[model samples]
Target: MRSVFVTGTDTGVGKTVVAGGLAGGLASMGYSVGVMKPVATGGILINGEITSSDLLFLQAAIGNTALDEKALSMPYCLKTPAAPAIA
Candidate 1:
């Protein structure tokens, strides 16, 4: 099992895009991928669920495969766009 982590000083950077690209690349090479976020503050309401678009893109890049048990757990959800510490 291999893993990569991407972090930055601010939001709206290329974290999601880069992660998705890496996942896509790995998936193209026939490796299964799992995407996760420990805490995400803001997200869109999709199908009655608050979902992070960043995560959505990452998951899509990895394809619609069944995620493992840990990845199936819910994320820390917040309603505002502010930092998690204050949200």
Candidate 2:
């Protein structure tokens, strides 16, 4: 199986866009694509739970909800709009 690790120069630098696009492209080529952000910051509180928009995009691209969005993508969520360590 092939894998990819996508990182950015800094936060909010279109990392999600690039990652999602790559997953979509791979899926279209008949490959099983999985995306994991590992850590996210600046999560919005919805219904008393933290969530990030990037994870949502990744879920949509993969077309599966069995993969835990929080566990698979956002293991750590920071409230402030900054780095995880800083926020």
Candidate 3:
């Protein structure tokens, strides 16, 4: 199994876009792909739950319905837009 980790020095970069693209591309090629955010700063309310858009994008990219397992993908999802420590 291969893994890809995307990181950026700051927020609002193309990390999510690039990661999602890679995951989507790999899945299209018939590869089994799993995506994780681990920690997220900002979130939006989805069905009464605060959800990370980046996680949702990654989940959609891999064509999986694992949103119910958000704890696995994004263990730390903060509603605040500040840094993880401050948020």
Assess candidate 1 and give its lDDT: 0.70
Question: What C-alpha root-mean-square deviation, in Å, does candidate 1 show against the real structure?
Answer: 2.8
Model 2: lDDT of residue 12: 69
Worst 10 residues of 2 by lDDT: 64-73
**Candidate 1: misplaced stretches above 4 Å?**
65-74
Better of 2 and 3 by TM-score: 3
Clashes of 3: 0
Better of 2 and 3 by lDDT: 3
Residue 37 in model 3: lDDT: 93
Lowest summed lDDT across 10 adjacent residues in model 3 is found at: 78-87
Q: Cα lDDT of all candidates, in order? A: 0.70, 0.76, 0.87
lDDT of 1 by residue, 1-87 (tens): 887887876777877788888889999899977777667778677657676666677777887533332235236656578864577
Q: Report the C-alpha lDDT of model 3 over 1-87, residue by residue, as the tens digit.
A: 778899887777889999999999999999998999988887888889888998999999989866698888989888888864477
In model 3, where do residues sit more than 4 Å from their true spots? none
- Residue 74 of candidate 1: its Cα lDDT? 33
Tens digits of per-residue lDDT, candidate 2, 26-61, equal 887988887787777777886677877778788788
